[model samples]
Target: MTYCVGLLLETGIVMLSDTRTNAGFDNVACYRKMFVFETTGERVVAILTAGNLSVTQTVIAKLRQAIARDDPEHSIMRAPSMLDVAEIIGRTLNDVHVAVNERMERTKYSASASMLVAGQRLGGQLRLFLVYEEGNFIEATDDTPYLQIGEHKYGKPILDRVVTPETTIEVGRKAVLISMDSTMRSNLSVGMPLDLLTIRRGEYRVSTRERIEAGDPTFSAMSEAWGNALRDGFLSLPG
Candidate 1:
């Protein structure tokens, strides 16, 4: 299991994910669940994934191979629009998922994966989409400006309460870390070495990317500050 969260704010987009995958207690390892594709000034895309590692890796490798082949029909870089890129990834994920599941069927194993794609094309709207294991996807809207995958429940409350289009990039980053801290405290499957990233709108580049490890000073401070704030808020509440 893993955890990945994406925040769509007024200034830009923020995404974070853990690097752990586990088949059992003895089979734990680190694999990046976050993937990025960009052309510096022209376009930038980041994909945060969860579920079956095999499925996600293959799907990404196929996408990269297609791009390398200059196969315009299957290449995300050749996509005419961000929506088209989302569509291509959705189809690839769906196809790869089913194939992997079938291969693992004899062992009674299930392989599945989902990806969150966030990026913008030149002259196109900055958008975010959650593509499911089945190849279908839903876009983030003003009403729901965020999407989460893998162990999402514990961290959703803060996002629901405070995130919005008017949110600043700095605050958005804090919110995601707090959100991840909450999930980490609650679940054993999600661990440290989190990939935290930000893509400022209109820049077509990821302006900030952070690798937060256990006991990182900034993260430690944020976690402590959040705890203090909550305690104070609770104590000051009228009973």
Candidate 2:
């Protein structure tokens, strides 16, 4: 299990994901779940994946292979718009998911996975999409400017109450980190270090990419503050 979230704010986009992969109590490991593709000034696409590690990894690998081979029809960098890039990723994820599930049919394993795709190309609109296991996707709209996958329930309340399309980049980043922190505290399957990325509007490139490890001072302080706030708020309620 894992947790990944993406916010599409007016100033830009913010994405976060945990690195823990828990197959079982005894089979736990860390694997990067955030993948970024960019051509410095031309375009930038970031993918946050959750679900079966095998399925997600293969889908991303295939996407990269297409780019390395310069296969225009399938390469995300060559897509005319961010929408088209989402389509390509959706298609790839769906295909890989089905194939992997079939191969694991005899076992007790599953190959279901989902992804959050966010990016922009030079002269294109910055957009975000939630690609499901079925090769279908939904875009983030003004009404709901965020998308989340994998162990998301534990962290959704903060986003629902605070995030908006008008949120500034810095605020959006803090929101996501708090969101991830909430999930981590409630669910052992999702743990640090975490991958975080941000893209400023119109830049056509990633503005920041960071890894927040367990016990990182900034994150730790924020998490502690949030906990204190929650307890205080609860205590203030009339009984």
Candidate 3:
């Protein structure tokens, strides 16, 4: 399992994903869950995936092939709008989910995966979508400016209390990092090394992209600070 979150705010979009995959206690490894496709100032799309590795990898590979071939009808970079891009991704994810599940039937394993789609096209509005296993998705709106997948429950409270459609891009990044920190602390399956990116509104390009490795000083410091703050807050609460 993994944890991925995307926030769509007035100023921009912030997304983060963990790089952990585990089949068992002894069979654990790191695999990036974020994929980005950008045409600099023309268009940009970032996908954060969570679920069966085979299904997610195949879906990403096909998406990349479409771009490499310049398939106008299918390439996300060529999609007329962010909505169209979400539709394309949804359809592809659904197809791959079904195909892979059939082959895994004998083992009773599921090939289902979900993804968060966030991006903007030149002159288009910034948009975010959470695509489900069935190929359908829901957009993030003002009432709920964020979407999360995988080991999400442990990390959701901070987002619920702090994030809003009007949140600043910098704050959004911090909130996501703290959220991921909380999830990693509570879940053994979700481990180190994280992918983070941000796209400013109207830029049509990624503004920041970073990978926070295990034991990075900055992240470790932030995590420790947050933990201390939480402890103090709990102690201050009335019994």
Candidate 4:
């Protein structure tokens, strides 16, 4: 299991993903789940994924290969618009999902994968898409400026309370960490180090990228402080 979340705010986007892939009680591993493609000042896109490692990794590898290809037909970087890029991703992901699922059937393994895509092309508006394993997708609108996949239940409350289209970049980043902290406390399958990024609107560049490890002092402090505050708040709540 994994936990991945992305927030599109007024100033930018905050994305985070855990690196855990659990096969069984004794078969758990870590793999980076965040990816970024940026052409500073022109295009900036980030993908956060959660699910079967093979499916997600293959999807990413193919996407990267497609974009790096010389043929315009396969390059997502040359897409005319953000919508086109998203459509391309959806189409490719769906194809990959089908192929991987076919193999899984014989092996009796699950190929569950979902990804959150967020980015902007120079002349295009910032857009965010939640892409499922089936290849279908939905964009984040002002009404719901965030998306999450995998082991999300434990961390959703912070996002519901503090994230919004108008939220500041700083706040969104903090909120995501708090959300991750909540999930980490509840799920052993979701562990550090966490991958995070901030893409500022219009800059088409990633402003910050970080890895929050198990003993990162700041993260540890934040998690402890958040927990203490929650405890105090719970005690003050009306019965």
* Rank by lDDT (best first): 3, 2, 1, 4
Whole-structure CA lDDT of model 2: 0.94
Q: Using Cα atoms with residue i matched to residue i, what is each candidate's TM-score against the true structure?
A: 0.97, 0.98, 0.98, 0.96
Evaluate residue 28 in candidate 3 and report its C-alpha lDDT on the 0 to 100 scale: 97
* Overall local distance difference test of candidate 4: 0.87
Question: What local distance difference test score does each model get?
Answer: 0.91, 0.94, 0.95, 0.87
lDDT of 2 by residue, 54-93 (tens): 8899999999999999899999999999999999999999
Lowest-sum lDDT 10-residue window in model 1: 3-12
lDDT of 3 by residue, 1-239 (tens): 99999999999999999999988889999999999999999999999999999989999999999999999988998899999999999999999999988888889677779999999998899999999989999999999999999999999999999999989999999999999999999999998899999999989899999999999999999999999999999999997
Superposed by TM-score, candidate 4 places the C-alpha of residue 194 at a distance from the truth, in angstroms, of 0.7
Q: In candidate 2, which residue pairs clash?
A: none
For model 2 the local lDDT of residue 20 reads 96
Expressed as tens digits, the lDDT of each residue in 1-239 for candidate 4 is: 89999987888889999898789969988889998987888888888888878788888888889887844765667887877777777777888889988887988776878889999998889888999878889989888888999999999988999898989998898999999999988999999999999988888888899988889999999889998999999999997
